[model samples]
Target: MESMEPGTVRPGGRTARVRTAVLQAAGDILAERGYSHLDLADIARRAGVGKTTVYRRWGTVTGLVADLLADMAEQSLPRTETGSLLGDLKANARLVQRTLADSRQGPLFKAVIAAATGEARTAEALRHFYDVRVDEWAPCVQQAIDRGEVPEGTDTHEVIRAVSAPLYYRLLAGGGRIDVAAADRAAEAAATAARAGVFLSEGRPR
Candidate 1:
């Protein structure tokens, strides 16, 4: 019966089971009906857990969403090591495209992003989730620098961010596709820009 806090993790045993069930239920509701429809009592019923437990553990809808986001960050796939900047970036882009195009995850992310606009707690949680993902993939750019593929002052994190930006735009906007071709184009654009010192610090190696 551990009380879960925003940005904190729960341990094993029944606590873990409860967390899993609750988060799954929360995600299902968010994906199907958006953030405004989330309720602790409904989530507890769907999860087959006690309403008292949900209330005591998460306390509020925002808290539960934060925990669900934390779980997603922890469960996200690891970065692939392809031994080349373009190869690594393409891998990253494809991962983003696939996740954003997924039937379940696509709507789930849309709900979260919409929730983030008006909810400070949800926005902070979403920021932390992207921060974790960016940190996970930034090393590939650094490795490129180490191998003389990019400028010494290249902003590695920015390059990583650029690779996924277009994919996300396509997801959020209604006019384009988030397909493999778009992913590859995004990755190539990032890799090319990194090589050309587009992400380098001002007055450094450009």
Candidate 2:
């Protein structure tokens, strides 16, 4: 598909193709050059689109990163629904593990995290990335509640966030290895916490 410049809208049928190309090129740049090295002109050239288009569409590197994160959220895996909460959490953990284990995504995330350390907009974009993933998996927690597996007022978002926190810690902090076993541990921890009412309220229903 021919790449369209960032802000340049092509024919209706080609819009998706253009967006895909732009996001792919952005991701490639993020992975290869780090955030500080990213330039709209370079992204346009790599995407085979016009520099003006990239400039008009994204305006800045932070803007491009935000859109890239949004696109990633759109393409992220749907949450699993195994019979048990642990099983479902394990599935979610594995999905996150697989994504982080990917060479391109791994570096792209590192670049984003590095950029976020210094840039407010980049930090917001990074937050958006986690928010999207957390939202995606929250329904699983709700399902667990519906099945009476956990307390009714459990904080689903926190439950979901707990599942990926360690994986990301390993990816960003170099504190540990990220593997299936690690994922299982994360899932188990989250499940255990959920079971122990860590995410639930102490008071009566309000």
The alpha-carbon RMSD values of the candidates against the true structure, listed in the order shown, are 4.9, 5.2
Q: What TM-score would every model get versus the actual structure?
A: 0.93, 0.88
lDDT string for model 2 (1-206, tens) is 00112233334466566666777898888888888888888888999887887888789888988888777765566777898899999998988888777777778888888888998987887787778778878898989989999888998998988888899899989968788999999999999999778888557353
Task: State model 1's lDDT.
Answer: 0.89
The runs of at least 3 residues in candidate 2 whose Cα sits more than 4 Å from the true structure, single-residue gaps closed, are 1-12, 202-206
lDDT of 1 at 206: 79
The segments of candidate 1 whose C-alpha lies over 4 angstroms from its true place after superposition are 1-11, 203-205
* lDDT of residue 102 for candidate 2: 72
Per-model CA lDDT versus the true structure: 0.89, 0.80
Could you give candidate 1's per-residue lDDT for residues 1-206 as a string of tens digits? 00112234446899898998899899889989999999999999999999999999999999999998888888787888999999999999988887888777888899999999999999999999999999999999999999999989999999999999888888788749889999999999999999999999778867
CA shift of 110, model 1, Å: 0.6
Error of 2 at 12 (Å): 6.3
